[model samples]
Structure formats: structure tokens, C-alpha cells
Target: MSRRRRKSLPAEPVRCVIERLSHDGRGIAHQNGKTQFVDGALPGETVMAKVVGSRSKFDELRTLEVLEPVAERVTPPCEFADLCGGCSLQHMAGDAQIAFKEKTLREHFAHFGGIEPEHWEPPMRSPDLGYRRKARLGVRFVPKRDSVLVGFREKRNSFLTDIDRCVVMDPRIGDRITDLRAMLYTLQAHDSIAQVEVACGDDAAALVFRNMEPLGSADYERLVAFGKAHDLHIYLQPKGPDTVHRIWPEQGEERLSYRLDDFDLTLKFHPMDFTQVNAGINHKMVALAVEWLDVQPGERVLDLFCGLGNFTLPLARRAGQVVGVEGDDAMVVRGRENARLNDLDNVSFHGANLQGDFTGESWAREGFDKILIDPPRSGAEEVCEYLTAFGARRIVYVSCNPATLARDAGVLVAKGYRLVRAGVMDMFPHTTHVESIALFERK
Candidate 1:
């Protein structure tokens, strides 16, 4: 058997009028009786787009010239917005971005779940720029350019974009991108450095370097010196995430922590731990989840996919008792430690895979009046069956992917739970990534 060859891209730029926006912020257009998804183009705009890829049903293009612009289109703040793939809707106005995300959530709910929310909560928002506290930067040494690039991948390409700064990232690390690039170029094992994982706390920032090769003594000294000068905590991971360890300022605190001032809670986590990238939105999101869940002082609450007790600890503050369950044992331990640190005795944590048959687990048999779920992109399909078994009267679902949330909503609705309220959160500004929350109550 032979595989069919992909069609070649057109050489000349084609003129097209963008009819609508796709879920990922790409503009939808039709040309030559086929659909074209153009990057950097907005709806109601006419542009010249260059074809870069071809598929059976559609072709992918990049806008080269915008002959007519739409009112929602604004100048991107980042200098490398055109080349960097870090953000998609940077050209769209901030207010319009929120509206677009809310619309996306609604569309997903109606199309996949076959229902609409009874109450539409106001969109949770935060600062548009310098809001990202966590990110993974691509590092590469290009011999042709005789320099090292330390930033995100280029748009529609795997190559690293030569960016000096990132507008969406927290300024503590964003402003140091050029310095990091220059530092990498000076290192002997520059080519061995594959990526940099950034994690920022309230007061300090940490960078974990994923190195493919061992560094020399001089290189180690230079990294330490750089960390000291910039007030950054540095870690090196020669292999997997478990191997990540701090090499600089070895005596002080290596843990990164953030505080929810309203709850008087401080949560500590490692550099590689799963956490919200936007700190501002996370603080607001937790408050909103607590409010919508309406956790009472006498109610028992269950928190699933709880990481470092971000929501679990806060829920414990309000509920009489809360049980936090996570898949990773390490996170469960951290969650317990966070509970202890906050001096909360009403919360406990357990490690169990929520995606599998969790009915045999000890926590599964417990009864609860309220439940909170914060699942990843895949959603909580496997665990929805057990909600009613716990005798949960109220459930609040915090979702990072709207499509999966909608699918699970259908399951809950079938199980006699009514979708009372739903809304989007601006966790990732200037990007199509949608984080949402919804409340469900027994009919």
C-alpha cells in the first residue's frame, strides 16, 4: 500500500474575506470552493493570505496583508506577535476576546450538551498583560544566525521564535528573556539546553533548565552567578522531572508559594507541579468557585483533581469537612502539607485515579452535600457516574476545556442534575484557551 502525497501549497498570495472566527482564533474564509483558516486575520476583514498547508477539507494560510481591518482588530502589544505562537488573539481587542470566549462556551454547551445554562454568570477577568506566572520556553542554538533563541515556537512552525520579551508573561521573567538568551549563548553546553520551565511565586521566580548534556564547571558557576544576580532560583534537570533540583542558593527556601489573601492561605508547590499560569485569575476563580458552590459550614464537600489544595484548602475554610482527591501521590502529599500549613484540621487528601474505577476506593463511599471538580482538558467523564452516589446536592465544576465540560454536562443532566449557571474565565489572555466554571444542582 502507498500513502497519498499531500497537495502542494499555492505560491502566490490569495485574496479572501474572513467570514468568521474559528475556536482557536483563526479566521474562517472560503476560496476556490474550499475553506481556508487564516492566522492573524479577523472576521469582516479582507486580506491577502499565503497558503502554508493543505488538507482534504481545508487549507491553512497566514495573513500577509490586511486590505481592510475590522473594529475588533487592534495592534498587538508584543513586538514578535506575528512570528511567535505564544498567543493567537493578540490582535483582537481585550473586551472582544472575553466575549468571544463566552460565546465559544455557549456554542459548545448547545452543540454538545443540547442545552443552555439557566443562568449566565459574568465572565471572570484579570489583567490582560504580564499575567502569566508559569510557562515553558523553547531554547535552541541556530548556527546560521550565530545566536541562541530563548522563547516560544514560531507560528505554524516548530522553530523557536527569536523574541526578546513576552508581553503576556509576568514581567519578572518576561523582561529577562534577552538576558537569558545572551547567557545561553555564553554557556559551553548551549546546544544541550532544550527548554526552560518558568515558575513564579508571589515574591520570587524560578527557572528549571532541561539539559540534554552535562555542563562543565564554568557553566555551572555562570548559572549560579546569573541566578544570584537576578534573584532567581535555578534548577537543573538532566533527565525527567523527578531529577529537577536546585543548584543555586542551596540554603534558602526552594519552594514556590502563592497566597489567597481573602482566605489567609498560602500554597507551596514545586517548579514542575501543575498550577494555574495566571495568578490573578486563579485567585478570583477560587473565590468564585467558593461563592457559586455555596459551601455551608455544616456541609461535607469533596474536591476532585485537587492540586496542592488550591481549591480544596479554600473550600475547607468554609465547609465543615472537605476531602481532596488527586491522581498524583506527590500532589496529595503537598495538599496535605498545605492544609497543615494553613492550620486547617477539617480537610484531608487521598491519592486515587479519578479516571478509572474509583468505586473501590475508601473516599468513594463517603457522603457529601457539595462537591467541587477541577479537571484537566480531558474532563471528568469517568467520575461523573459517582456524583449521585455520594449524595451530592450541589456540584461546581471548574473546567479548562469547554468542549469536554459540555460533554460531561450532558451526563450530569441525564443523571437528574440541572445546569444552573455557567461562565468563562480569562485565565489566559490573548489566547484561545478557555477556562470555565459551572454549577449544577439536583432537580
Candidate 2:
């Protein structure tokens, strides 16, 4: 049997008047009675787009030329903005990007939750560029290109984008992309390096190289010298995250730590641990969560999906007692250690599958006057079922995905909670990924 060949993409450019922006930052237009999503085009703009993909419901196109530009459109700062998938909204003005995210949150609330917030808090803002403190960059050696690509994948493609610098990433690492590429080229196991995981703390930055094979002696020495010369903490992961160990400054603690000066607390974490990409936004976000929860001195609070006591310790400072629950045992342990390091006696952490049957957990039986939830992208559907039982008067939910947040908001509202306040956080600027926070109060 002969295999079928794929259909060729349309070579001709199609004119489109962008009606609106999709949640993922694509411009939506109707062409031939079907919706078309055009990349690199803003809402209220006329553009000529080339079809990259065609489907039954909608077609995907890349903007070839903008016939009419919107006021919000701006020249992208990064040279690789056209190809790099790291940032989708660089072409849109910073203020317009924030507005678009706020619009997205409002739309999700109305469509998925069947309700809207009574009060809209001002969208939290932060530095729009060079603010990313964490990232997992792909590294690929393509012989055809005759060079190793050390950056994010191309827009809507599997191939890595050949970029020398990323404006959105922390300048400490972003500025060294060329140097990193050069160093990798000099390594004997250059192709063996699969990824570079970056983690920046208040005072230092660390990079963990995920090596697919054992590094030669010279390669290892070169990595150490490079780390020393660049003033960076370096580590190698031979297999899994658990295998990540520091190679430079081999004497003291190599843990990366961020300080929350407002709370007088410091959180130390491993490079492989999950953390907010934007440290400034994270600090502000925690402050917002605490302010919204408004836990009184005698109040008991519950924090779900608590990682490294980011919220638990802060809440403990105000509330009488705070209980943090997380699924990862390592994270739970780390949270406890953070609490200990801060001398926070009122805060405790437990490990349990929050999305599964957590009814038997002892923490589930405790009454909470207020609660703070920061679940993963899947949202807290299963946990929402048990929230009402805790009799929490106020709940603050921090979400990375608006759709899931809206869905869970519906469940909470159905349980007699009112959507009191909600807003978006510019945690990830130049990207359509929305980080939102919402408050619900039992009426």
C-alpha cells in the first residue's frame, strides 16, 4: 500500500480583517464562512496571511503583510520574535497585552462560569522584559543549519528557533546565549546535552544541564571553568531531576533562594523544583493573595497546592494557624523546611493527592475560616467539592489557566460563594499565558 502525501499549504496570501484576538494571542478572522486564526496579527487590523494549516473548523495562517495596523501594534524588540515561540504578544503594546488578558479573563468568567466578578481589581503589573527567572530551554544540533540552536521551539513547529538572545528571559542567562552556544560547541558531548534549566535567585543564578550521556573529562573541566568565569552556579543532570548536582563552588550550599522582604522570609529551592518564572510578579501575587484572604489573627487558613510554603508562611504570620497541602512529597518536605527556616510554628504542610480522594486526610476535617488555592493548570475541580465543607468564609484562588479557573468558579458559586473580585496578573509578559487571581465570598 502507498502512503498518502500531505497536502501542500496555500501559496497565495489571503486578505483578512482581524475581528478579535484569540486567548492564545492569535488574531481571529472569518474567511469563507470559517474562522481563521492568523499569527502575528493584532485585533482590528487588516493583514495578508498565508495559510499554514487547514482544518474542518478553522484554518491557521501566518501574517505575511499588515495592510492596516492597529495603534496597539508595535515593532517587536526581539529580532527572533517572528520565529520564537517564547513570546506571542511582543508585537502588541505592553498596556494592550494586559488589556487583552483582562478581556480574556472576563470572557472566560462569563462563558464558563455563567457569572462575573462584582468588582474588578486593577490588573497587577510588573517589569515587562528581562523578568523571567526560570526557564527550560531546548538545545538541538542540526547539521543542516551547521549550528546548535539554544532557545525555544519555532511558532507552532517542533523545530527549535535559532536565537542568540531572548529579551523576555532574565538578562543574566539571556545575554549569555551566544557564550553558552560557544561553550557547548567546544564540549566533546555537545550533542548529548538535551536542555538547559535556568533558575535565578535574588543574588545568584544557576543552570542545570540535562546530559543524555556521560560527559568527557575535558567537557566537565570546561563546564567548571565556564561557571567560575561567568559567576554562575552550574549543575549536571545525568538521568533525572533527582540526579542534578552542583559542579562549581563545591563547598557550601548551592540551593537557589528568593527573599520575600515584605514577609521577612526566604525560600530555598532546588533548580529542578517548580517555581514561578517571574519573581517580581510572584512576590506581588503572594501579597495580593494575603490581602484578599484578609485572615484575622484568630482565623485558621487552608492553602491548597502549596509549594515551598510560598503562601502558607505569609498567611501564618497573620492567621492563628495555617495548613498547607501539596501532592509532591518533596515539595511538602521543602515547605516544612521553609517554615522551619522562618521559625513559623503556626504553619504545617501535608502531602496528599489534592485531585483524588482526599476526604480521608486529616486536614480535610479541619475547619478553615479562610482559604487560598493555587492549583496547577488542571484546576481544583476535585478539591472544590470539599471546600464548602471546610466552611471557609473567604477563598482566594490563584490560577495560571483562566478556563479552568472559570470552571471551578462556577462550582464554587454553585456552592453559595459569590464571585466578589478578580483580575489578571502580568506574571508572564509578552505571552498569552494568563495568571489570574479571583476572590469568592460566602454570602
Candidate 3:
């Protein structure tokens, strides 16, 4: 059987006035009965867009030229923002980006949850740029260019963007992209190096190089020298997660920590462990959660999906007893380690699959006065079903995806909870990723 070829796109740029922004930040316009999703075009602006993709219902186009610009549009902070996939909304102003995210969350709440908060909390924001603390940079030695590239992939394509710096990432790593490329190009195992994973703490940063093959002595020494000169920690992964081991600063523990000054707690984590990418926003989010929970003395609190005790430890400081339950056994161990490091004996961390019924377990038997949940993108539908069983009066939920959060909100509302206040957070700026927090009180 012969495969059908995709229909060709129009070569001439079509003039269209963008009607509005899509959920993912693309501009939507309608020509005749077919819809057009144009990149790099804003609402209320006219642009000439060329079709890059086509479908029976809608067309995909890239802005060829802007005939009229909107006030919300601005020069992107990063030079490569238009090409790199790392940031999608860089052309939009900072305040406008937050407004778009808030609008996105509101729509999600209305569509999926079928309810709205009694009060819309003001958005919790951080620095609009230069705040990313964790990233996995794509590395490749392009044979055609005979050069090594280190940065994010190009928008709508898998090819790595030839960017020298990333303005959105923390300066320690973003500003050194060119330097990283130069160093890797000089190494014998340049082609063998697949990617680099970066994780940063308050005082230090670490880079984990994923090497597809073994590195020679000369290449290894060069890596160490680079680490020493730049005052950065170096790690190498030969095969898998277990093969990741540190090489530089042959001394202290293989751990980096960020301090929560408000709670007087220091949390340590491994380079590969899951940590929040925005440090400042995390600090504010945690504090806000603790305050909203109103953990009175002698009250028992339950923290679900706790990782490294980011919220659990702080809640532990306020409540008499706090139980942190996580799906990952590794994170449970990491949480316990942080508890000991902070000298807090009031908290206990346990490992359990949150997607199933763990209600009969000992952790669930203790009724909680207050609860905090920070689930992943899937949100906490299964857990929300049994939240009433815990006898918690107030619940604070931190969510990375607004759609799932809204979907889970319906389950919670049916279980007799009112969404008192909800708001967006600038956890990831210059991108369409929406992070939100909500407070629930027993209705």
C-alpha cells in the first residue's frame, strides 16, 4: 500500500488579524471557515503569516511580517527567543504574560471544574526573567557545521538551536552556554556527550554530564580543570542513574541545599532529585501555604506528594505532628534526611502509592486538621476522593497544571469543599506553563 503525502502549504503569506490567544499562547484567526494558528503574532494585531502546516480544520502558520504591532508586544530579552523552544511568550510583556496565564486558569476552572473561587487571589509572582535553577540542556555535535551546540531545541523542530546564551535561565548556566560549547568541542569525547543536566542550590550549582561513552584521561582532566576554574561542581554519568558520581571537589557530601529563611530550615537534595526550578517563587509558595493552613499548635497536618519536605518540614515547624506521604521511596528517604538535617523530630515521611487506596494504612488513620497537596501534572483526583476521610477542615493545593487542577476541583467540591481563593504563580515565566495554588475550606 502507498502512503498518502501531506498536502502542501501555501507559499504566499496571508494577511490576518489575530482574534485571540490560544491556551498555548498561539494566536488564533479565522479565514473563511478554516482556523489559523499563527506563531509570533498577538491579538488585535495584523500580520502576514506563512503556512508551515495544514489540516482540514485549522492551519499552522509562522509570522512572516508584522503589519501592525500591539502594545503588549516587546523585544524579547534573549536574542534567540524567537527560535529557541525554551521560551514561548518572550515577545509578550511580563505583566501581559501573567495576565494571559491568569486568564488561562480562569477558563480552565470554568470549563473543567464547573465552579469558580469566591475570591480571586492576587497572583504570586517572582522575577520575570533570570530565575530558572534547573534545566536539561540538549548537546550535539552537528557534523555539517563541525561545531558543538549546547542549548534548547528549535521551536517546532528537533534541531538544537545555535544559541550562545539564555536570558531566562540563571546567569550561572545561561551566560556560560558558549563556554560550555567551547569546552566540549575541545574534548575527545565531544560526540559521545549526549546532554548536560543542571541543578542549582542557594550557595552552589552542579552540572551532570551524560556521556554515552567512556571519557579518556585527558578529556576527564579537562572537565575537572573547567570545573575548578569556574567554581562549579562536575558530575559524570557513564551509563544510568546509578552511574552518576561526582568528580570535582573531592571532599564533602554529594549534596546541595537551599535555605528557607522564613522557616529557618535548610533542605538538601541530590543533583538528579526533583526540585522546584524557581527558587524565589518556591520560597514564597511554601510560606503562603503554611500561613493559609493556619496550623495551630497540637494540630495534626498531612502533606501529600511531599518531595524533600519542601512543605512538610515547614508545616512540621508549625504543627505538633506532620506526616508527609510521597509516591517515590527515594523522595521519602530524601525528606527524612532533610528533617534530620533541620533537627525537626515532629515530622515523619512515608512512602506509598498515592494513586491507589491507601486509606486503611496507619498514616491515613490519623485524622488531619489541615492538609497540603503538591501533586504533579496529573493532579490528585484519587487522593481528593478520600480527603474527607482524613477529617481535614482546610486544604491547600499547589498545582503545576491548571486543567488537571480544575478537573480535580470538581471532585473536591462534590465532596463538600469550597474553593475560597485561587491564584496563579510565575513559577515559569516567559512560557505558557501555568502554576496555581488554591485554598479549600469545608463547606
Candidate 4:
């Protein structure tokens, strides 16, 4: 059988007026009943957009020229904002971005769950720029250019965005992009470097280089020297995540930690462990969830999908006991370690497949009156099935994906919980991703 040839997009830029915004931060335009998702075009804006990709139902486009500008549109701060995929909504004003996210959250709730929150909490915003603390940057050396490319991928393209500096990333790594590229270009294994994983704490920042092959002694020495000069921790991963090992300063400590000043607690984790990308937003988010859950002194709280005890340790300070359940045994150990470090005897960490039937587990049998969930983008639909059994009077859900959150909210409502308050968090500002929290009480 012969394969069908893909259709080519028109060459000339087409004029259109953006009708609204798509969930992914694209401008939605209708032309002859076919929708167009135009990048860099805000809602209510008239622009000439060039077609990039097309299909029978919808089309993809990029703004070539804006004939009319919208009130919310602003000059993007980053120079490479047009080419880099680091942030999609940088052109939209900060306040407008938050409003769009709030609108998206409400639409998700109404469309998916057929329910709305009784109250909408004011959005928690990050007050500063360059707040990102974690990222995985792609690294590649192009022989044709005889230079290295170090940054995020191009917008809507698989090719790496050849960017020198990033305004959204933390200064620790963002400011060093050009320097890193120069250093990598001088290394013998420059082409072998796959990517660099970045993680930062209040006092320290670390870079983990993923190498496809073994590095020469001179290259290894250079990487270590670079780390020493910058006062940054250096790690190397020759194969899988488990192969990540530190090389700089022969390190006294293998982990990085951030402090929750409000709670006077510090949590530590390995450089490769799961952590929030934005430290400031994370601190505020934990406090917000704790406040909404309303944990009493003698209450037992359950924190599902708890990683490294971010929320568990904090909640343990107020609740009589807090049980943190996670699927990864390594994180469970980390959670226990953090609890011990904090000297919180009331909190315990357990390892269990949250998607499976784990109510028979010893930790689940304890019965929690208050609950908190901070699941990944997949959300916690499977665990919602067992929430009613836990008999928790109040549940606080911190979600990264609004669609999944709305779906799980429906399940919670069906299980006798009413969504009382919900709001969006500017955890990842300038991006389309929405981090929201919802409070559900037993009806």
C-alpha cells in the first residue's frame, strides 16, 4: 500500500481576527468554519498569520504581522521569545495571563464536572522575574555551525532554540547559557553530552550532565573546574537516572534543600529527585493548602502523592499526625528522612501504588480526617475512588492540569464532596500550564 502525501500549507500570510484564546494559549480564529490556532496572537487581535501546519478540521499558524493589537498584548521581555518554547504567553500582560488562567479553570470545572466552586480565592502571584529553579535543557553541537546549541526547543518545532540567555529561568543557569555553550564546545565529548538537568536550592544550584558516552579526563576536569569556579554542584549521569553521581568538591552533602520560612522547616532531596520548578510558588502553595484544609491540632491528615514530604512535613507541624503516601520507594525514604531531619515524630511516609487498591495498607487504615493531594499532570482519578472511604471531612487538591483536576473534582462531588473554594496559582508564570488548588468538603 502507498502512503498518502501530506498536504502543504499556503505560502502567503493570511489575515484574520482572533476570536478567543485556546486552552493552550493560542489564539482561536474561525475562517469558513475551520479553526486556526495562531501562536503569538492574543484574543481580539487582528493579525496576518502564516500557516505552519494544517489538517482537515483545524490549522496551525504563527503570527507574521499584527495589523491591530489587543490591550493585553505587550512586548515580550525575552529577546528569543518568538523562537524559544520556554514561555508561550510572555506577550500577554501578567494580570491578563492570570485572568486567562482563571477563566480556563472555571471553564474546565463547568465543562467537565458540571460544578462550580462556591468561592474563588485570589490568585497567588510571584513577585519577581527569573523565579524558575529547575529545568532540563537540550544540548547539541552542530558540526555545520561548528558551535553548540544550548537551550529549549524551538516553538512548535523539534529543533533546539539557539538562545544565549533566558529571562524566565533562574539566573544561576539562565545567565550561563552562553558560557556553557562555549565551555561545551571546547570539550572532547561535546557532541556526546545529551542534556543538562538543573536544580537549585536557596543556597546552592546544581547541574547534572547526561552523557551518552564516557568523558575524557581533560573534559571531566574542565567540567569540575567550571563547577568550582561558579560555586555550583556538578553531577554526571552516564546512563540512566540512577547513574547520576557528583564530582565537584567531592561534596560534603549530596542533596540540595529549600526552606519554608513560614514553617521554619527545611526539606532536602537528591539533585535528581522530583521537586517543584518554582521555589517561591511552592512555599506559598503549601501554606495555602494547609490553610484551606484547616487541620486541627488533633487531626490526622493524609497527603497523597507526597514527594519528599513537601506538604507532609508542613502539615505535620499543625496536625496531630500526617501520613504521606507516594509510589516511589526512593521518595518514600526521602520523605522519612526529611521528617526525621525536621524532628517531626508525628509524620510518617509510606510507599504504595496509589492507582491500585491500597486501602488495606497499614498507613491507610489509620483513618484521616483531613486530606491533601498534589498529584502530577495525570491527576488522581484512581485515588478519588477511595477518598470517601478515608472519611476525610475536608480535602485540598493541588493540581498541575486543569482538565484532569476537573475530572477528579467530578468524582469527588459524586462521592459527597462539594467544591467550596478554588483558584489558580502562578507557579509557572508566562507559560500555558495552570497550577490550581481546590477545597472540597463533605456535603
lDDT of 4 by residue, 160-219 (tens): 999998888889889999989998999999999989999999899999999999999999
Native-to-model Cα distance after best TM-score fit, residue 174 in candidate 2, in Å: 0.8
Q: What TM-score does structure 1 among the candidates reach?
A: 0.98
Instruction: Give lDDT tens digits, candidate 3, residues 197-308.
Output: 9999998899999999999999999999988988889999999998999999789989989999999999999999999999999999999999989999899999999998
TM-score of 4: 0.98
State the lDDT at 51 in candidate 2.
96
In angstroms, give how far residue 107 of model 4 lies from its true place: 0.5
Candidate 2 structure lDDT: 0.92
Candidate 4 clash pair list: none
Task: State residue 355's C-alpha deviation in candidate 1, in Å.
Answer: 1.7
Per-residue alpha-carbon lDDT of candidate 1 for residues 1-443, written as tens digits (9 for 90 to 100): 89987667789998989999999999999977899999999999999999999987899999999999989989999989988999989999999999999999999998984779899999998899999999999999999888999999988899888899998998989999999999999999999999999999998899999989999999999999999989999999999888999998788756899999989999999889988999999999999999988988988999999989999999998999999999999999999889988999999999987877776677767688999999989999989977888878899999999999999999999999999999999999999999999999999
lDDT of 4 at 237: 98
Off by over 4 Å in 3: none
Model 4 Cα displacement at 239 (Å)? 0.3
Error at 102, model 3, angstroms: 0.7
* Model 2 backbone overlap count: 0
Alpha-carbon RMSD to native, per candidate: 1.4, 1.2, 1.0, 1.1
lDDT of 2 by residue, 20-92 (tens): 9888999999978899999999989999999999988899999999999989999998999988999999999
- What candidate 4 gets wrong by more than 4 Å, as runs, is 1-3
How many backbone clashes are present in model 1? 0
